[model samples]
Target: MTTLHTPRLTLRPITPDDLPRVLTYRNDPEVARYQAWALPATLDSVAGLVSDQPLGAPGWVQRAVTLRDGTVLGDVALNTQGPQAEVGVTLARSAQGHGYAHEALHALITHAFTDLGLHRVHASIDPRNTPVAVLLTRLGFRHEGTSLQSYRHRSEWTDDALYAVLAAEWTA
Candidate 1:
């Protein structure tokens, strides 16, 4: 498993023990509502998702965000394609707005671009998710464009904003 440490957080692989905490954020109505998959998250479902994939695959990295105190905050991952990787993050509702996501994302990006030798990382966010969009911008991600009706949310189609940051563009 791959593990990374930041000033205030640690990013590590998701384990079976993390299912309960993962479900906390996954089950949140607000969180799930904006996500492409809106079905209620169950332990079995989460297990299935993680079990089907390997951590730190050749082109991908999936990790659980945790605090120095050992609190599991959420998840952060990089799904890779060639030299670019797609970033995804989910923070526990209670941990939101505390900069934990930012800390974890920075660490993950550094690992992907520096340690893993990746060239670029990007994220697809629902336009309605203003906080995430703002967060990505703060992290040096440029808004590339929007995809119309690109994702299915609660049985309806929704638009997504594409945001990207290049290795040379990252200041952190």
Candidate 2:
């Protein structure tokens, strides 16, 4: 079992029991505003989204971000393909601004660059998601570039912001 504990959160594979908690944040308009997934994601869809996360599985590894009291705050997802990986984070509306997202992201980045031996970790975000962009920058991810109108987010086309960090940069 691969589990990571930060100062305030435990990162573990998303389970079937986390449906409601996951949905609470994942379905919220505030959280889903800049996300690629359609808002009001159904329970069945959320279940399928996390069904393949088995510990250190190589495809899409999604971990439930939980507090010390076992309350699900949100989730962090990493997708690995070949030598590179991309990551994303989501937090409940009620859990924002607490540094929980920061803690969870730091732990996951460490795992990606150290435990997994990935060459580079990257993130792509809707250009309008300023908070996430700021968080990624603070974590030492350099803004690589922007892909204009490269993705269709929700019902409209949106630009994508690309950011990345190398393994050497992380281990330093």
Candidate 3:
């Protein structure tokens, strides 16, 4: 399992004990609003998802983002596609606006590109999520384009903006 340490957070493989906190953040309408799917997440569903993660897949990694104090605050993942990977993140409401997402994501991206030998890492965000767009841009992700109605959330189609950063663009 891959583990990444940031100044205020640790990103490590998801475990059974993290189910409750994961559901707490995922079930929130505010947080689910921007996600690709908006299912009412249950413990069983979370367990299934975590169990299904492709642990041995080359260049694929998923980690639970926790505080140094051991509070599971969210999740960060790198889904591989040839030389590129898709980056995904979800943070608890309480952890928002404190730079934890950026910090954790930065660390994850570094590991993906540098250690995992990926050439590019990308993220897709709901166009309405201005904060994430700004964050990605600040992290050197260039706006790649948009996918119309690419995400199905709550039985509705939503547009997603694709942003990406090349390995050469990463600084930290």
Clashes of each: 0, 0, 0
TM-score of each: 0.90, 0.94, 0.90
**Clash pairs, model 1 backbone:** none
Tell me the tens digit of each residue's lDDT in model 1 across 1-172.
Answer: 6788988888877888889888888999876767654478778877743533533355545688889887898888778787788988888888999998889888888877887677888999899899999999999999999999986777778998999999888745
For model 2, how many clashes?
A: 0
Q: Which candidate order results from sorting by TM-score in descending order?
A: 2, 1, 3
Best by lDDT: 2
Score each candidate by Cα lDDT: 0.81, 0.85, 0.82
The alpha-carbon lDDT assigned to residue 94 of candidate 2 equals 86
Best by TM-score: 2
Indicate the worst ten consecutive residues by lDDT in candidate 3: 48-57
* Candidate ordering by lDDT (highest first): 2, 3, 1
After superposing candidate 2 on the true structure, give the runs of residues whose Cα lies further than 4 Å from its correct spot: 52-56
Kindly indicate the candidate among 2 and 3 with the higher lDDT: 2
Better of 1 and 3 by lDDT: 3
RMSD to native, candidate 1: 2.2
